[model samples]
Target: MSEHAAVDQEASNARRGRGASGGAAARRAARSGGGPGTQLTYIKRKINVYEVLDEEGLALIE
Candidate 1:
């Protein structure tokens, strides 16, 4: 690939690693739903917002 393509690919990959996906995975335990005792009854193991708690160490001011 050209130098520009290589740089773009690398930057994209790095962004993904440090972007929302990474955060989601790291905080999956808190955001995931479909666990036992939760309101979700369709899927016991399904991950949803209900199971997520606002404890990602980062929050919006507004």
Candidate 2:
């Protein structure tokens, strides 16, 4: 194989390896809530909610 072809193959393999491992690591981080020391804080709403349904409409659904 040519030097260029070999380099391309190596890069492709590296990308494939990174993608496989990165996916599992990403899932783990997501499940772990970004590891220890990360505080879960409530995000305050910037905009007020627009109430579309009235009390009667809500009561009928309930």
The TM-scores, one per candidate, come to 0.30, 0.27
Tens digit of lDDT per residue, candidate 2, span 1-62? 69999999989988786565567778889888885875789998899889999999999999
Q: Tell how far residue 2 is off in model 2, in angstroms.
A: 0.4
Alpha carbon lDDT of each predicted model = 0.64, 0.84
Consecutive 10-residue window with the lowest summed lDDT within model 1: 53-62
How accurate locally is residue 35 in candidate 1, as Cα lDDT from 0 to 100?
57
Total backbone clashes of candidate 2, pairs 3 or more residues apart or in separate chains: 0
The deviation in Å at residue 9 for candidate 1 is 0.6
Q: What lDDT score goes with residue 33 in model 2?
A: 83
